[model samples]
Target: MESKDLKFEEVNEGFNIKEAIDEAKRCLNCKNPLCVQGCPIEHNIPAWIHQLSMGNIGDAMSIINEKSNLPAVCGRVCPHEKQCEGHCILNKKDKRIRVGKLERFIADFDSNMGLIREKLTPKTRGKVAIIGSGPAGLTVAGDLARDGFNVVIYESEPEPGGVLMYGIPEYRLPKEVVRREIHKIEGLGVTYVTNCIVGQNITVDEMFDQQNFDAIFIGSGTAKPKTMNLPGNTPRGVIQSSYFFRMVTLNNNGSVGRNEVPVKVGDIVGVVGCGNVAMDAARTAIRMGAKEVYIIYHKTIEHMSALQTEYNEAVDEGVQFLWETNTKEFVGERGRLKAIKAITNEGEKVIPMDKILLAIGSQPANRIVSTTSGINVDERGYVITKERPYGMTSRKGVFAGGDVVNTPQTVVLAMRDAKKVAAGIAQFVDAKKLLEE
Candidate 1:
């Protein structure tokens, strides 16, 4: 699809009722359920499939909710090929099950039918504050809120979904799905405070002293984009993939206008990196009317961190790839990127490009920890935490999880860690409260 012709159409057309039923019937309902084992969040794959096959979609959705708070978002974005469906027994026969599609189907069905009933708790426990409204933070908030903890999420952005609302494009993961999932969290009695920067506006000690939160869960994802130290990085046309994605998502969601989205049509775009974010950047560029889109990766195709399905989709959409190529510098004219100079095994080559999107990776923002004294971070800036207490940080009442601790992992994997951290927080806060009593 040409950029001018590209509507914000959803990439994956959701499964219809009949298709969902047929797919549910395909599940062998393996006793071992390797799909569940393979999932980072350990969704009850077999149980959900059984419920779906029996036409008990609400029950299936409930089963999915037990493990994941963002089923709809995960259904759209999670790389099932590398995770859950990757281990399906049917894969031995070279026929992998459509696990992602089915999960998406059930979740969408429940959402459309308004079958989601809030899971209520008996009484409120101690209060917990979650930083960031991304996957990990939202998961922790949902888990703790359901456990009767007064959970409040603080998001620095205007919206609460974090990366889901900013970094991901609407074509891949719709904003509506993100909004619906967030609504479920809010229904659980969790409060969200937008445009609230914890380290800046309110310090950790201040939260402990004034707010009196029993425990703090830091899920502020790695927002700082990792850049190539190559020359011309400061050029006008050189931009980080995260920033570009945020602009596009915000524009689509009406937070910004279309003119502010950047990357106009007919521009030659080059994306540096081979991860899923790179693919998203390349694809988004295509939809934004880029005449040519190329993904440059230093490693071989096999070593590319992006899921094969994402790569295939990008290729299908006419996005080009230059594997085994390392960018040497961003060649530009008058402070604007004009081309990219790269070195491959063949020799030095220069590709003319109007825009350079850096999707290399990201590092955790240090502002929060650097300003707060009690918390401890390693030389590399990752928070120091013990496994027994799961997500507990250097401070006794503080916990950290998700991309800040583990460099930008998949959304579901982050949620898995968040769930563990939530449990740990509950135990710690409960014990502390009991002692106080």
Candidate 2:
């Protein structure tokens, strides 16, 4: 490994066993449990914390597995400040119980000690084929597999984890943690097929009719990154933050070279936008040995979509923030990016930059919809799902959820949607089988 890659080691070292118990012991285990209400998937926060406090690692994991398939991933990445921990009763006293850290500790301890290995249920319910092995697809597969449905996930990448294994940076979420979680899911009788693109290699029709998938789920996330399309966007150094993140991850994992990673060492990099992705890109640039990394946002810090914790960490890591700055144009020459023309509060400013990474956001790709006949999408190409069956698409046996159906969301939000879709798929499959019998 390159000496520079050492900078990418996990920044946050979660609680030790003793520290976790001490923190978990502080949880009030409230009857109302506002933390549960705050969670997107309604995790039984109090129960798991209580279990961890008692050193019942297996019990805590069982509680977590009831609502979550990727406890370790969530423990690391979920926005605790805005959700569960935010609503903790102790927050009023400035003592929020450190729920995220405690959860991380429990998950790590459980995985390390092999405290809980669930018994696999027979796949007698039905066979469900899931597209994309992201948070949503894994949740659906785990949930249905527990309920006796045979689940197979098709992933286009070399590995099963979609964004978890690729899009997210290594420092925040280690690939090993992701692999561990996926390994747990696979233990539940779920099958994975990598390097398989749903739209191209096989179509929805083949899965439903030929391969005999009783229900099909689309959890494929937003693949097409959105760009500002400024005057000099076509320049060589102008890159999409998502693509940059994916390539850098691949490079770090030895699948690709440093040259393929896009951002080079000692480069002066400026990232456009102020969301989490923008923070990730800028911070990643710093770790890659960039001379300077700047986050250029048109809005004030008050309006930033990034978590305050993430922004604070980026600042601590020496990331420069350009706030309330409106980008006018990309000023470059020789087909390579060099500077950005913008207007700050003071007046017009020309910012010199060697590269510009756009972290604006993205939307779902039309690959599956365009290739399939029955599944319908909205004007913006998001799959149209019904509310009655919950995540059922226009076509009867076809279902869609996660970022593919709604706009791009956080990992936990995607899992929440996928869980509902899994239930809906189970209902549809059960009814069809009964009628045929």
Quick one: best lDDT, which candidate?
2
> Residue by residue across 189-292, what tens digits does model 2's lDDT show?
99999999999999999898898999899999999999785663467888899888889888888998888978888899989999998999988988877888
lDDT of 2: 0.89
Q: Which stretches of candidate 2 lie over 4 Å from their true place?
A: 1-6
lDDT by candidate, in order shown: 0.88, 0.89
Clashing pairs in 1: none
Q: Any idea what lDDT model 1 has?
A: 0.88
List runs of model 1 lying over 4 Å from the truth.
1-5
Per-residue lDDT tens digits for candidate 1, residues 383-403, read 777786889987898999998
Output the number of the TM-score-best candidate: 2
Residue 298 alpha-carbon offset, candidate 1, angstroms = 2.7
Q: Residue 325 in model 1: shift from native, Å? A: 2.7
Report model 2's TM-score to 2 decimal places: 0.97
